[model samples]
Target: MLGILGLDELTERVYRELIHLGPSSVEALALRLSLDRDRVHRSVQMLEAKALASRNAVGQVQTAPPQLALGALLTAQRHALGQAELTAAALAEAYHSASTRSMHDLVEVAVGADQVRQRFEHIQLSAETELLALVQSTPEVVEPGQSFAEEEAVRRGVHYRVVIERPMLEEPGAMESVLGEVLGPERIRVVESVSTRVLIADRGTVMLPLTESPQVAEREGRRLDEVGEPMALVSRAPGLVTAMLGLFEYVWQRAVPVRLADDGLDAASADSAPTTLDLRILSLLLVGSTDAAIAKQLGLGLRTVQRRVAHMMELAGVTTRLQLGWQAHERGWLS
Candidate 1:
């Protein structure tokens, strides 16, 4: 029972025997436990160190009163724990400094969904400035309540920017749920497709799946299977992180922004703009289709599609195509 205070089994046994026998000699304890005298002597020394036993002037070992002895042991244990906590704090600081110096060796390979999720939560909690994520598909291994960490991070002022694929928004109330959980719609963007799943923090650390071929992953943006064990790569390499930042920025520019109704519009007000044809164009834009692709899908000329898009942008009072999409959604044109 007192082993937590550094008492070995033999010491505890001898101490109990001494307490029971009442002021016993080492030989007597050895005989009672069927242990050798030398072993019993060693246990006495350990018990003395723990303040559980003491020696009189005649060199006879005596067990201290259990009340006093146990109390002293508990106090010593508390003091030791306090010191250990201080030492741990100092060690953590040193480790952080060393990790910063060893960025090249920071790349790690984690196997299975649990490990990937754990790494993601750690990165989010450690983020100081901003977080950028390209979510192509949801992993099936999400632990219950794990999303609370992300919500807390956002509340603490970590600038979060997530680009989600269009297909994920097809689920009923999906957009509403995301907007409610995150700070607002401005933090999210939608793309027709995402090439890969990525999470980058502070432009210093990057993480992505390792099981898929990079080229195929980028080209197809396939969903990860729920039953499959996924592997991920985490890195803090400066050059690699820089390249990832560039990729995120490129996608961010082309992606359509999501504007929430709460930003300033009632349901009726939002449903007041854009004709059916303009709504069709906005739908294609939401899925990340190009002007030519939009024209081909709607059986219209490329120039005609471009002209309509430009007119919508003018009506929405936005300069960029992506911003136009945001306004269309804001006005409930694509709702």
Candidate 2:
């Protein structure tokens, strides 16, 4: 058989003898095989190199057990395997937690105007110590029963600081009166500009329309016409929440404190008047209401509104809506 594989017959014989007897000294092995001691020793060395056998000191030879350990090998393998499984489970858990945070931490679409109002109510109700808000209006365009919610929130003793457009201060209504009675003169601050509406609650959360097109309208009976996706250019990350909070601080710094009864003439007149048309255009822009809406609200033609806004933008030296809003506030025209 060894001849067919091209191996020496003595080499084959030594291999068979080692299998029958587990371990043996070189002299005993040589006596049993009837081969010279040197030849037996050489055969053992070849078997050991092939990993079929092993040698001990004092010239004893033994059959090498299988490379695989039974229980102990399995235990070591399982310990390594268990570590990998635990690591994978941890990574999966972390991914799931991050997905949940992304979904819950930011603004989302509310179903209806009523639903939007409800969300605002919920935010107001959830306030702990203070509420700082920047929006187009002071009283806010609340549905019928929201006043009760505001009253309930006020009763809880939350400090409310707000910045609003000048027209909202002039509007005659129970809503305006209610704000005056509750928040008092000290809490209300007003600024002027043309931009989208933004409302911040307790310096933690913010609400802004994500739509780039002004044509997209909140359809009747549909509160959420679209999703409130986070601004990609701006960091909505938690680490930058303080930066957004800083924006409110900057606006608050430039805003003027006022009471509904005060004519705002004192503040408005403190600086030289920017021509009546400039004041009108600047006021409309600050409220986040569009040019057409402002024209309709002020009873002017659309073209006139557009021309006036263009003129105001050129005069104010601002390139973007956000900057325009901030500039209008800084100039104290919206107040």
Candidate 3:
């Protein structure tokens, strides 16, 4: 209907009369449509505003070509409708994806420090069964005890597992405080190095940096903190969670246990134990150091290094080096 194009009945009739009569005076148009002259003049003015009609010097209104005028309006509206259709379809796709809990909701980006901090706390507080951490910083620097919510998470019987890299081990008192006080030594492990920081809760949700490390970014000549605040991503997608958990497991299995309490008892080593020198020797061995290399590093005789290793194996009741490594880890002797 022409009404859909912003023309009411009287305005449309006046336009139609102009088209039919070629050109007509306002008074004649009003007489023919049975309308007052003033109303007809207003309709003609509206038609002129819409470019559907105009007056010549003689003051008679003439219609523009219908195809050029109304056709253009129709074409513009069709274009607008097409754009609206695309928007609607996209919204519907998002709605359906959300309703099904599909992979479309894979990564939720948290930009800026406040958002990243909130996500970090959310993952820790929302954990139901287990909390796994991959920390590159000192254990105490990451989160310490009297560990407020961390203690609360522990109280809820949430299993906490932490793996720290060598950089963390280099920190003073890195192992004696924080998680040590809250979770004990058995919950902690250490590896030669960890690629990045990750916090996973119940293998269900993960919070991690949005991009790779600055070292990685530097290869492309971009700084990670160029935008001032770091960004983090939280994912609840099942596949992503499983993949992240797999990565954690891969790192955890190879990590040796930390000695949280300097005086803690080791059932395997209680009678004749590995001393500070012995633990250092074991730490070197875990990094693939030979007996000769271990002796040189620790200023001990090669025989002394070999004897300490052999004695440790005997204390662990293990016959092979591999089994001894496992047993030493179980007894929490390595760094």
| TM-score for all models, in order of appearance | 0.48, 0.44, 0.53
Judge candidate 2 at residue 28 and give its lDDT.
Answer: 86
Candidates 1 and 2 compared: the better one by TM-score is 1
| 217-309: candidate 1 lDDT, tens digit per residue | 445766535225668889988888998999899998787765443333321233335555656557657776677776765566888788777
lDDT by residue for model 2 over 1-335, one digit each (tens)?
Answer: 63433336777688778768867887888999887999998887776765666777756687765343223435655788899999999999999999887865553565444555666677778776676666654222453224565666677887777766555644334224535455542266567732545555666666544343212234233344353422312123554457667777888787655433333342123223355554654554554557766666545678877766665566678887678667776877645
Error (Å) of candidate 3 at residue 227 is 6.6
Decreasing lDDT order of the candidates:
1, 3, 2
Tens-digit lDDT string for candidate 3 (122-156): 67778888899887652212344434667678877
lDDT of each: 0.74, 0.59, 0.74
Q: How many backbone clashes does candidate 1 have?
A: 1
TM-score of structure candidate 1 = 0.48
| Candidate 2 worst ten-residue window by lDDT | 227-236
When summed lDDT is taken over every stretch of 10 residues in candidate 3, the lowest stretch is 138-147
